[model samples]
Target: METESLVETLEAAGLSPYQAEAYVALLELGTASATDVAEASSVPAPRIYDVLRTLEEREYVETYEAGSLQARAHSPSVVLDDLRSRANRLEAAAEEVERRWEQPELEAGGASIVTQFRTVIERAESFIEDAAHQILLSTTVSNLQRLAPALRDATERGVSVRVSVHTDDAETRPDPTLFEGVCVEARHRPLPAPFVALADRRRASFAHHPDSYDRYGVLVNDRTHTYVFYWFFLTTMWEPWETVYEATDPGLPTEYLDIRHLVRDLRELNWQDAPVRLRVDGYETDTGEERTVEGTVVDVRVPFASEADTGFELAGRVTVVLDADGERVSVGGWGAIVEDLEGTRLTIVDAPTVE
Candidate 1:
């Protein structure tokens, strides 16, 4: 390193500018009078004595009266050790910066904006690991591989994990075997899509594709915010995609946190004339009063055309007509207004008994 840069580095390592310059000069001179060091370095002759004395106190130099007061640089071993320690600290700090850039910490109960897509993926993995009931994830096949372990663990714990794998084309689609045990179902989307992960309706992670003009990510722990991302996943990445992999039916008594999913399953069961019983847990839409209703599902209604499946459109109503004892109660999903009850948890209490 240049002498000037060496002096600057020494200053950064806790030595004053004059002390650093004087020490550097004495090292070069072998041993020098205070006046000689000032002439050799940029330090002023008037301040050289005090600067050398301070360096001596710091053990960077040993000063003694050699005819007149003289300063000699400390052993190179001691100085080199201090410089090496500083370098090691700086290297560790650099690693920490990169780690935070990739896996930034997200605060609880709100949304955070981050600059790296990796941050969203890491947050999503954490949410998947903690997921109790359900997970909806839309990402590239490579990211699917990265999160496979966490998703598999969630499935082993009985969490419903649905993955939408986006690819550039059918030619680029991954093998179905890749998702066999990692998720309950895997869908193939033939277009580039933003990464999204929603866990148990409460936490969500979203990020634009790296190719996007504005690259960023959002981590959300609020139910309300995640609900929006859930719809985005449904309309864009999920409902429209073709199913590539589905686990063998671990048939009934299955539980659903999404009323839309519940409605879809009920539609199929009703077509086969299967008897469906449910334990509906939620709040009364009108009064926000909690209610649990155990009944048989009599009807599944979606306000679109009779033949139309509940696809991306959310403009119409989707209701489950439940016969509770003698009274018929209309149950709806998250933001239910037309229905009497807003269902939060729906468990199929009876398995299909179709012949």
Candidate 2:
């Protein structure tokens, strides 16, 4: 392949070009002397010792006898561990950059802060190969180029990886062929955005700008609802590319809508029976902001209900302040999915605030 890019990529993996070159050369030429590594890496004979010294210190290579230094790759398991090590370092470095960004005087256009983003991509690449459960990705040809290996790996692991393949070639795009042998499916959509990967619906890494992709990206792992949007967006793109239908009874109990809406709007206190002056003890199931909202409930799904918890399906004409999550809501969360309906009355501890 391209040695320059490979060297750059290895550098990204915490190797110096000299180290990358010398090691790669060793792999290509088999155990070699300092003279060999110097000639192979194009480093001057005098500087080869310095590069070898550095690589040797990092356990990337070993030297024995003057003029006789040989590079050795850590075993795959050890290499993977080492990969994770650098990823952790990059994560910490990125965190520091983010902390610095919070500084009042840390303005843009100074120092560029590009290295921080490069570390983010590094973090994403490290975690991508190990992705499990689900893979939510947004596409850009360039960003996907960096993520291809991870997606392929996830697919091989049998993870349900769904991708947002935004391309101009709508019909011919996605090249489903690209993922045929793997578990991942590349779907096409219209997003003029760089790549984003949400692995296992937990952590997410998204590129900021094309030119600066190698310079900066953000890694939001366990961040509040980053993956939720990623999942929602992926679902929106992939849900109905094909058509299907299911039948439901027209008349369902309001008790069902009550809990569903409450959970949906719990963050903003959209309890139908109440207003905003509510207690925090009434933890929001919705996670949206609370305020006075007058509108018809549009849609809802109650997974479980009993005498203590009124459960039913509710849908109607509607409008309300959507969660900061834009306009997507689908009974999301791990709150009690199935509750007793003992009282036959839905609970509302308080109402929303009068805006």
TM-scores of the candidates are: 0.79, 0.36
Deviation (Å) of 211 in candidate 1: 2.9
Q: Any idea what lDDT model 2 has?
A: 0.50
- TM-score of decoy 1: 0.79
For 67-94, candidate 1 gives per-residue lDDT tens digits of 8889899887877898899999999999
Displacement of residue 160 (Cα, Å) in model 1 is: 1.6
| Clash list (residue pairs), candidate 1 | none
Best by lDDT: 1
Total residue pair clashes for candidate 2:
21
lDDT of 1 at 249: 69
